[model samples]
Target: MGGLSPAKRLYQTIIHQYSRTINCNSSNHLAQRLIQEPISRIKTTLDSETVNKSGDENLEFSWDSLLTCVHHHSPPKAQLVLEWRLEKLLKEKEKNENLYSDLIHLCGKIHDPQTAMRVFTSMESNHGGKPSSNVLDALISAHLSSNNMVTALSIFETMQNSDDYKPTAHTYNLFISAFANLGNSKAMLAWYSAKIASGFLADLDAYGALILGSVKLKRFEDAEKFYGEMLEARIKPNAVVLHSMLVGFCEQKDLVKIRGFLKGVLEHKWRIDGYMAEKLIGFYCELKLVEEMEWVLVALTETNHNQDLDTVSQIHNGLIRFYAKLDRLDDMEYSVGRMLKQGASFRSHKDVENVLCSYFRAGAYDRLDVFLEFIKDSHELARSSYELLVAGYRRAGLCEKVDLVIKDLETQRKE
Candidate 1:
């Protein structure tokens, strides 16, 4: 035994390590002493009738102990013991009633999905026992977790057709959701549509998935169509569906349609809030559609006249900024005046600067004069406001007028 090769010595070291934990400890430097015997000797001892005598009580502890060794040892070192012990328990046991659920669950915990599938398949073939929903669900989820959608779909298709395996909406929804997660939105939509045509109405979750996917793909038309079909099928839209539609419309900058849809929600006595209105207003303003932005703001005030002040300010600031960006001096002035009339006077420095810049750039000398008269008479000049007027005079070929402003500033400072 001492004359054995180091490779054989390493194998013996592993077996002895496990034996120390499971059985009586002997300083059996079984390392060199046991090296001459075949590795199958240890494998056989693990799977022998002696261990099967206690049935699942002992099988559980044995398998659990064997698994720890299998994980700790390299594949070449533990392969014989792992395969032999698994085969022995599977073949020799009549049925493990108490361990069935646990074993089924264990199949999912195993890293190699193919091995888990083989174990489950073997259990079906030898025991002729039907797998439970929990077991099947675990198997489907396992395959999905591995991104093996083809195998997972095959299992789902079989389950749907089986008399014993009743497919619930959750089952279909889950399969659809897995495909959706893969960004196979078209396939996800087709599957549910096919199921519905076959007279199987998947739950709202399935439709919700389609809506979200369609929105993500920027297919607002498809999303809206699918939404209508859901409603027509008598599947009420949940908050997610409603929110998805709102966000989809917002992305498309369809403020008009969003307003109409939101109004419909309100007419049904659904709650409307300032945040939703802000989203609508912000979308239109981003598109620089001043008219549509105003329409949404008016609708908001009409729907909830006591709208939050902060929301009102956000909407007004957005409108001013939009017109100013386009250099629509008249439009910008009108929007600011309307906001002031609405008693919204906490002006944004940015909004004021934008208006001045637009006015200066527009080169409307008469309009610049009106602004100057307003500033002088009002006796209110933000530091930048005067700078804009000086720039405005220079651009209008009134350099003398600009110099006059500088002279006035010097006199005021001296005084």
Candidate 2:
């Protein structure tokens, strides 16, 4: 076994081990042990024996085990293992499409597009093998992974010109996704149009990328247009895409469009998630659309029974903060009550500060006293709250009240 090449030695070791195990144990037990054995251990064992081995030997290598290591281990080591295997395969004049594809994909995974391209080039010239579409796709994907869009597109063009390969919807989606991630709306749309012209209908992922890219570019109208096209094509928008569109509308501050779009969503009985509901309430409050805000809040409270507690607390705090800013103490108190009913602690320091300031600014001493008492009973008053109260009293020429607040703060700090 030591006289044999590393690949042959590895094969012999596996065969001997398997034969010995099978003879002593039941087949089921042997199968279970093999299934439970970690691929990492196997790869490590092979790596320890194979390192420094020459590729002059024409022994067969287990590509599957090597590929597994390439995916799950360090890229540099995996690449070395792959290169070693490729050299052996080449020396034996064996052509394996899967091995070449995995090599290209690993290069991409490691962001080594140069090595990936070299592997691709050598597949035909050095290995005398025709590159399949899958291999080309891997090469293109590798370039895209590195954000080398120019090289990726060049390879894609090459693939298109080749008689043996044609780009799939997946390939086009990668371009759209890359451009979208770069926030290049123009390029993304151009590619989208090209995809459509190539007689391939845009999939859900393609539409999502286009919608997001348009939104990032502040092209709300175009985003809506793409959404409409999605609807017409009967391609349902997922929660993520819908939220992106809503966010785009909010950014554009087109209240009419948001209202109409939301109305349509409700009319069509589309699912409105907690995040979307929160955004709607926030935007409505920002626009001072009290009626719309109230409607949405009511619907959200009713529908979001099973929603996350943190999100519900955030929505309540948002409403309280908004109402406090407008000096609507009654509405603010109402929101606070709702928040408390949900078993949420009043934790937003900003909202507490805003309400306190609003009361002091409006000379509503009675309301301010009530709020202070409430905070005291709830034990939610921090040292910062006392400081803010003292500042407010001092600003209002209430020197005695300021002194009292300072004393209270000192007592609380000691406690």
Candidate 3:
């Protein structure tokens, strides 16, 4: 233990702490076991590796679990499971440069540049491992993720010094994306120029950066110009490119471009993310094109782009809200049933309130009661939602219905 490095000591400390607490809390036993089981397995595997000392580079040490900590969590915000395990990971005398690359990539993703650097430096110290192109890219990205441009570029310059790890188109895209996000068109173009001078034409990702930047800056014409050049390069526009184009057209209210873009989206079957679905649905709704909005849902199903449950729910909820705003009860009510049939339901309380309010405004009190009953079985009808209904009905002079809402709230409390 005295011979162990700080990273190794920390790893052992964590394992020891978890082991000691494994049986201490009876109420949280199941939860604690679920959390600690994998960690215990990791410790056991490491102990075995130490005993065997085979020094196999590819440790096969739960890549999925390691990478899972990266998603939807920033390092500063999360406990950073990756940071906790990754530095210790490199203490192993193995040359898993690829594994290290993935670790550093996750470090970049979580915006933990310090952990990224630790893992990178550990590569040479532990196993005399040389950095790969992927390693350098991830290292660069780790710095960029923290907006540490000086460090990122210094790393990029180091790449220029290494013949084995020079900048590729993807490396250029990293800088381009970082600058584009900063809205620094000058720096973005400079990187693009450098990419071209390096004898690498702009790839899909680089063009994506350019288009996305242009769209963000509201430079529709520049975005169109970049899109045209992308086409001239004989590169098929990806979902990101198409999404940017659609957003530009939507902003400009250029229906001709929108129609062409949507038609292309349908024909080419591009992936529509949740944001895209909401934007497209809201765009058409702004134009009062209800049929077009429904067609978007149909198009999603036909194109098999509705695989994400969240995105599907987003589309359905957007439509429900829009239909309520239009006071189209028949269509809105049918959509509610259809959303359930698709295994998506009213996930947002505000949307449910909008639906109830629509029914109330239309004087469909019987239908309102039916709708409440229909959803009550599945939806967690919040007390605040009941309060809202009572308030709405009371203002509309529906005394009896207000009493019913109060009763429902009381019943919910009892339940």
Model 2: per-residue Cα lDDT over 1-415, one tens digit each: 5576433333233234333432312323322333444645533544444444564332244444544444454555455544554555466565777777877786776666666756665566444445666776787788788787666776676557655567878788889988998998878988888889989998899999988888888888888888998999989888878899999989988778877877666656576677886787678776888777766656556665445566556666777778889988898878777777767656666678888988987899877887778666544676677889888888889988888888887787788
Candidate 1 lDDT by residue in tens digits, 1-415: 5985443333243234323432301112222222333665755444342344445323434444344344344333344433453476577774653344344334333433455455555555445555555555655665665676666666666565555655555666767767767778778877787667767766788888888778877788888998888878878777777878889988876657877887776555454455565666667766667777777667655665445656666777778778878888877777776776765643445566676777777766677566556545324455566676687788788988789777876676676
**lDDT (C-alpha) at residue 138 in model 2:** 85
Tell how far residue 293 is off in model 3, in angstroms: 2.7
lDDT of each: 0.61, 0.70, 0.73
What clash pairs does model 1 have? none
* Model 3 TM-score, 2 decimals: 0.69
Residue-by-residue lDDT tens digits, candidate 3, 350-393? 98989988987898888888888888766887667888888878
> Which 10-residue window of candidate 3 scores lowest in summed lDDT?
22-31
Per-model TM values vs. the true structure = 0.45, 0.60, 0.69
How many collisions between residues are there in candidate 2? 0
Ranked by TM-score, the better of candidates 1 and 2 is: 2
Q: Name the lDDT value of residue 142 in candidate 2.
A: 81
